[model samples]
Target: MAANTDETTDAELVAEIARQVPDASADEAAAIAVAIGAHLTDRQRAAAAAAAAAGSEETWDGKEWSFSGRIDATQKRHVRVRQESPTDPWSAAGRTDRM
Candidate 1:
């Protein structure tokens, strides 16, 4: 099951990321957690708008968005996001990569 992003704090996100990726340093985990938190927040808003405007029979094309940021002095993380776009069933809000 996915963690509920609504109630998750930055510290909690960092902890969860650490648990999921034991090899990442503390700073790396924290960076990735923050990025994930932002992604989830944006997706939640899009889902709400889609719910309001979407038809029951609507079908979305598969899409994935990568959220990238500097994790540390030596490395970075790229998060691949996939979900239904708001109001538009053919593309994501910012960027689109076919999944």
Candidate 2:
């Protein structure tokens, strides 16, 4: 689901989550929303980390190419990442370094 986290307040998240689980108590709904939100936040962080792992950047250079991702070292974690403009001539020519 596309979301603007900056505009998604905690209470709003709780309310939305409660709406999804109508049977849950207010406290239960809030808790579920908090947990779910945290997971989603972590997922985003992991993906961002993967894109920035090589350095403090979200791209390969001052060009159209770009990369971003994250790696979750936690017990339940897995790989998450993204690379843009893979069809660029430089990429097609095969560069040795990986972002």
lDDT of 2 at 89: 47
Poorest 10 consecutive residues by lDDT, candidate 2: 65-74
lDDT of 2: 0.55
Worst 10 residues of 1 by lDDT: 65-74
Give each model a TM-score.
0.40, 0.42
Against the true structure, candidate 1 has what lDDT? 0.56
| Model 2 quality (TM-score) | 0.42
Clash list (residue pairs), candidate 1: none
CA RMSD for every model?
22.5, 16.8
Segments of candidate 2 deviating more than 4 angstroms: 1-9, 54-99
